[model samples]
Target: MGTKIPISVLVVIHTPDLRVLLLERADHPGFWQSVTGSVDGADEPLAETCRREVLEETGIDSAAHVLTDWQLQNRYEIYPHWRHRYPEGVTHNVEHVFGLMVPDAVPVTLAPREHLAFAWLPWQEAAGRCFSWSNAEAIRSLPARAAAW
Candidate 1:
């Protein structure tokens, strides 16, 4: 099996009105988060990683929407259960933040192996529902960030 990289992308998919799309992880049921995935290779561009993850997990072609790199990065410890996906001694990950703005709350086709369910919630509730602090923080910043866009 191929090892995952320590770098990943967290793409917060949302609608114009600040509704955020969150996915329930299949591996950890009830744990919801934004579209996230590790870089496929050392050379993969972060933007492409974001687009690929959004498409793979939500069946949303992010290119058709307004996908923006927020220029934010967070370093967090890897969850013990998921650490096996990386190489030994890889205990932390650097996650880049991104946002994808859709015209409306569209239906998503979740990947069975990665996600079990999905929801479109108001930004505040979405932030509360997210299992990751970085994901929640990103969602909470949407209103201000969207205003500046």
Candidate 2:
């Protein structure tokens, strides 16, 4: 069997108005996060992985949105229960961060197998409620990053 790629991408989809989009995980009901997916193969670059994942998970075209590479990555152990998706002895993953800027907060179509629901909330509240620390951190960094541009 082929080895699982430890690298992945977490994309925060949001609007210029500070409204962040979140998707509830299908497997973990209340656990909400941004668009996320693993690199399917070793040849995919991280940036391409980011763009591809956002589209697959959210049905939003990355080219039509502002997809930014935050140049940040987080390495964390895979939760024991979810480790079956990886190869034996694989204990952690490296997640790259990205931000996809839509013009405004709007209804999104989620991949049913991956997510069950979607919500748009102001950045502050969105940051406060994300199930993942890395997701919250990315939301918290939005204002300053958006302002700088």
Candidate 3:
């Protein structure tokens, strides 16, 4: 595969009642977070990346939900283990944040290679469980975002 784009999307999938969905990484076992993936190509839109990752990772058709781009972006150093996926010397990534609101906690079909398991937890608990700081911050912001939605 070619080197991945440094741009990515972090999608917070949650219910109207503040229950957020968390996915366990197949590669990391216990490391859990929201649906996240790099853009498939340099020309792809971040929102499209968000939608695609949500479906590819959790089987959630985000097009059907209220997928709102929070207009938030976070740039962080790529973890050493995952840096190999990007171009040589590219050590950071810019992740656009989005929120996909479903009516309630819903069953999900995990993509076996990407995710090993899934859970819907209260927003507070979900935030606490996220492995990435950026992912957790997005979950922590869910309550206010949902309140305004």
Candidate 4:
């Protein structure tokens, strides 16, 4: 695989009622997270990256929903086990946050190679189940964030 960019998007897909969608990683059976992926190229817009990831990972077209760039960003260390996907010496990542609000909790088609299963749960429970701290933190912010939307 080619080296991935150290910058990425973390999209919290949720319903108007605050139910969040979580996908279980194929590489790590029980590890769950929101829709995420690196920017395809340096020139790609972050909003496009966010929409692309949501569609690619969960088959949900973010453009059809109320996709909002929360303008929140988090810098976090790349997990040791997954660091090899990036260039050598890349130990951290910058994640841009976004929120995709659908009308309700709906079915999702998981990209089998990237995710094994999926679930829609209350935002609090979804936050608790996320494997990444940033993902969890984003989920935890859903209520307040949605309120401002």
Candidate 5:
């Protein structure tokens, strides 16, 4: 397998009403977070990667939604169990932030191998439920970020 890139995109899918979308990780059933995926290759810009990941993982057409690049990034250690996906000696990843604003909470088709189910929850509750500290941090910052827009 190719070396996993140390960069990723985390897209917080939410509506103007503050309903946030959360997807349960397939590998860790109860662990939930926003839409996320690694950048496919160096050739793809991060914004494109965000759009692609949202569509691939949740069947959400990013172009149709308002996808905002939040201009934020989180550098975190790779989870021990997931370190195998990275190249030897790689220890950290940089996850860029984005947000997809839909009109309302809607059903999503989770990619079976990556995610099991989905829910739309209030931002405060969603922030508290995310498994990753960085993911939770993003959700927690959403209100302020949205306000800036």
Candidate 6:
């Protein structure tokens, strides 16, 4: 497998009413998060990475919905356990944030290998359930972000 790039995208999938979709990591049962993945290659666009991860993780075609680049980014230390996925000595990842707005809480088809379950919850509740601070912050911003859209 190729070493993962430290640059990634975090796509917060939600509904117009502020219900956020979160996925349970198959490898870490209780750890839930939004759709996240590194770019396929150095040349891949962040927007394309967001679209690919959204569809790959939730089986939701981002092209069919309103996908908005929130222009937010976060840099955080990579969890020790996941460091092996990246290049040697890499310690952090820079994540670009995006939001996908569906009309309502839509059913999702989770990729069994990557995710075990999925839920659509109110933004506040969803934020509380997220394991990653960055993910939670993004969900918390939904009210303001949705308001502007």
* Candidate 4 local lDDT, residue 44: 96
Off by over 4 Å in 5: none
Per-residue alpha-carbon lDDT of candidate 1 for residues 14-100, written as tens digits (9 for 90 to 100): 998999999999989999999998899999999999999998999999889998999999999998887888898899999999999
TM-score of each: 0.96, 0.94, 0.96, 0.95, 0.95, 0.97
Per-residue CA lDDT of model 4 for 1-149, tens digit only, reads: 33899999999999989999999999999999999999999999999999888989988887788888889999999888888899889999999999899999877999999999999999999999998999999999988887776
Worst 10 residues of 3 by lDDT: 140-149
Error of model 1, residue 98, in angstroms = 0.1
Q: How far is 48's C-alpha from truth in model 4 (Å)?
A: 0.7
> Candidate 4 — worst ten consecutive residues by lDDT sum?
1-10
Stretches of model 1 off by over 4 angstroms after superposition = none
Error in Å for residue 75 of model 6: 0.5
**What are the clash counts of all predictions, listed in order?**
0, 0, 0, 0, 0, 0
**Residue lDDT tens for model 5, 1-149:** 23889899999999997889999999888999899889889888998999899988999888988988888989999888888888888889999998899998866888999999899999999999998888899889888877887
Off by over 4 Å in 2: none
Clashes, model 3: 0
Candidate 3 residue pairs in backbone clash = none
Candidate 5 residue-wise lDDT at 141: 88
Candidate 1, poorest ten consecutive residues by summed lDDT: 1-10
lDDT per residue as tens, model 2, 1-149 = 23668888999888899899999999999998888889989999877888888778887878877788899999998888878888888999999998888998766779999999999999999998898998899899999998998
Q: What TM-score does model 6 achieve against the real structure?
A: 0.97
Which candidate number would show the highest lDDT if scored against the true structure?
1
How far residue 1's Cα lies from its native spot in candidate 1, in Å, is 9.4
Ranking by lDDT: 1, 6, 4, 5, 3, 2
The C-alpha local distance difference test score for the whole of candidate 5 amounts to 0.90
Query: lDDT score of model 1?
Result: 0.93
True lDDT of residue 70, candidate 2: 92
Clashing pairs in 4: none
The 10 consecutive residues of candidate 6 with the worst lDDT sum are 1-10
Model 6: per-residue Cα lDDT over 28-139, one tens digit each? 9999999999999999999899889998898898899998889999999998888999889999999999999999887799999999999999999999999999999999
Full-model lDDT for every candidate: 0.93, 0.87, 0.89, 0.91, 0.90, 0.92
